[model samples]
Target: MAKFDLKGLLNDRSVPDRQQDQKIVYRNPKDLIPSEENFYNTEKLERLKQSIKLLGILQPLLIENRDGKDYVIAGHCRRKCCIDLLNEGNDKFSRVPCVYKTSSELEEDAGQEDDIVRQIMIIQANCYRDKSDWEKMTETLKMENLVKELREKAPMEGKTRDILKDLIGTSSGQLGRYHAISTNLCEQLMSEFEEDRIKISVAYEISKLNKEYQKQACELYEEAGILTLDDIKGLYRQQEAEKGIPGQMTIETATGQNRPPEDDTEIPAETQIERFYESTNKNMKNYIIQEDKNMTIFMLSNLYGTARVRNGHLNYQGTTAGITFNPGRVFEHELSWQSLAKILIGKYGHKKPIKMVSVDIPEKPKKKDNEVSGPAKCITGKSKSGICGAAAYCDTEYNCCAQCPDDCNSRCGWLEERCQPAAEIPDEKQPDFVEEIADHPGEAAALPVMKNNDQRKEWLRNYKLWGLWYEDKNIGVKYYKYDFENGACLIAEEYILPGTEWMPEHETAFLHLVGGPEPECKGGIPKWTYHARYYKFPNSETELVEFLKELQK
Candidate 1:
């Protein structure tokens, strides 16, 4: 018998696809050594079992004789099925057909423990099996190592991926992505991916994060659910930006070398305002560290700034430059704000005591919700009762009282029996802000200088602009109007209609003020629901700005 053409047989170009010993013989199903690698999924394996239970082993198992033992190279599913049937008292499956490789056909070095030929032949035999992305990744990675050994052992003619493209039937680019996912993703993330819990694209994006961020992302996924590509990318960017700050539980911190002071007494943080300037040293602003929590959380209640180290100074930009320890650290001792500030200066700031000031805290304006805002009006023409009127609350897309006519673009879904016409509803209300601002001119004049979007957003909320005007370089200009006059503020995009100033379109978002308005109900709680395409109730103006910026991107 001639030497077995394993490579030619794998590529399907050889005449003899089987070993030299062609005679098929019956053997004990339990006696055969099962291959450790099985690529068939559970459903397919079940189907294979059913097929063998009815037809028996139609195809003989391709067996390799290693040191007087029969090892299965193919037909693993068939042999397992036969053994299962035999266990179920079906004596017919006690013996199964198999074709064994002749001793002369075996390579001289094939008896070695880590024989590369055996590994390649095993993977190549199941190349056509249905496999998940994770399975493909794992198998391809194995093949990559084996192929590298093969190249070093006997100089291959093509690149590793090219050789793999022929051997495993996976693309080169896909193989690269697989390698990246295998190397970068945390073990928890990899397990989730293996079970098909997380998407491949999302997993690939998460693979770009460092180990700490990867662990964080895995935790977020387990807590909140699977994260999207955008979420992972945002996390990656945040990790990149915070790299200079340290205290991300590095080696020293993790080993407790960088632990806080011994005294754990709580100290009231003193308020200190420092005159800080931008990178260009122009447009100086006052940055105040109002309070601290565990000497870690330094909140700039009235300011927001991005801090960075520049030219040997703890430089910062924006009005709210806050200095504090990283919140992720676990400290045993509590330190005063002054002490924490000194530590910050040692790391990223100038070695000097911060300037102090006794500025008066401004009083926040109280909101009156039950004042003059009218009810939501229906736009879907006459209801079954008569002409549909304004509703105490127009049902949003979440729960529609009635099937809307125009996809509820008007954000109105009042049932015919429930709502009346505007003529009968009779909304008689007065403006809340015009009179107050007119009376307190000094209070109105004390508005903060609108230097950034954060300040501008604060101005809008304080003065009650009832709208958001944003100008983007790429998107040109866009405006979002708040319909506060109608119960809950139905945030909608307003468009100019000929001579009309602005007409509100469908509701894109909404804001329900703490003391905003009361709904006049005929029955049931008013559901001011619309198909909130996107909605977020940010706790602060800075957060709102960040959310809007993400939307623009």
Candidate 2:
């Protein structure tokens, strides 16, 4: 029997030319509806550059035919890079391959054009080339363009509904949040939000207040310099107290404070939604805790949704995540919460719902819907598996699928008993199985935990032991070493004590430092190693010392 060469056959296939009979070859990136966001964070750009470097002009720059030349369609970044390369005399810059694009080119005049597509190319570039503060401004412009488009399309029928779905590859809900930001906030607050001193969601909330009241709130936030959501609530209380209201749960204290409403009449629903958005939105600000090669997680909110952690860096799924408890950002509004969850799920893996502390006191809402259910949830002895964790890790291990008699795969947290917390084990530890997902057995693979390409957490623990380990109750200290392809694996900094034995069970070499009091390198071999050689990273004696310092701190 003759065997067909799949790889050779596939690679050998030619890209046949498109039909050009009487057909009008559509040319313009403006016509295509992108399937995903052009999130050009650093990693993506490197890939694009590598591709451009490796395979010159494989994909053409899509453009609309304008007066006999190509008017760029979707690959703006490639165009810029082409120009850059040409200016630098790089031969690869001569020609770029592209797909003919079709988009609502007319929308450019009507305010509903294709902006994300054009921007992604630049994102594709900056993600690896060079990033500046202008990226933030670029994001602001993209956000403004979307707002304008929403305003134009929103008036026309059948648009708002699309905002809920992945329309044009953008989360319409997140777009709506960006669009709604200034509409619900004031100029001063908006400006502060741009500087990141205060939060966008918080500004949105204040925007809901009367102009005069919003101004007053902005003044308070600026004056405090360091502001918390509770501080804003306190200002609200101060206003009520000035009005001689009896008592209200406010920022001054957890206990009921003296603050009376001017009138018992309800606040507007618009006002309530705005307040909810602000409180929840402040839960994140581009913060990060760790970085490896495989993933990047943004734990925007605390376990119970009270606060947010802005960002984290990662290369692979470094073994840290195997033991690390990174949570998600939660918000008050249903859409934002869902959208944040969606992005989190799509990007990093899922998380566990955090149990928050409760106020344990009763308070009336300024609006009817502003009940305890509105702002935050206090997690007691129970925990909810994070949205992704629920779908992946939690469900399979606890036999949660057993509850869905008809369909185990369905999303039925309410109807299925297994969807809820398990009774057999503590909610926090119930879904610890990474293999339960069956697809990515090396939960710690990305974390550089798979030292010898063997699936186990033991290597990661050993790696952790290579350096000093310190846990800060306030700052939450965690230490790790892994690849940087995901984003950040800080081995470039130091390696104080790589300990004593030189076991070479694996193909790689090892060293055990003689000065350590006890045997540090007790293990035979690491499960995973990202270095060309272990000696490479701990390059200088000073860096090694600093690594030890991080361990103690």
| Top lDDT hit | 1
Residues 392-498 of candidate 1: C-alpha lDDT, one tens digit per residue: 23333211223334444453444546533335553233123222322321222333344467655654454334434321222222233332222222232222212
- lDDT at 486, model 2: 26
Q: How many residue pairs clash in each candidate?
A: 11, 61
Q: How many backbone clashes can be found in candidate 1?
A: 11
Best model number under TM-score: 1
Structural RMSD, model 2: 34.4
For all predicted structures, in order, the TM-scores are: 0.39, 0.27
Whole-model Cα lDDT of every candidate shown, in order: 0.50, 0.36
TM-score, candidate 1, is: 0.39
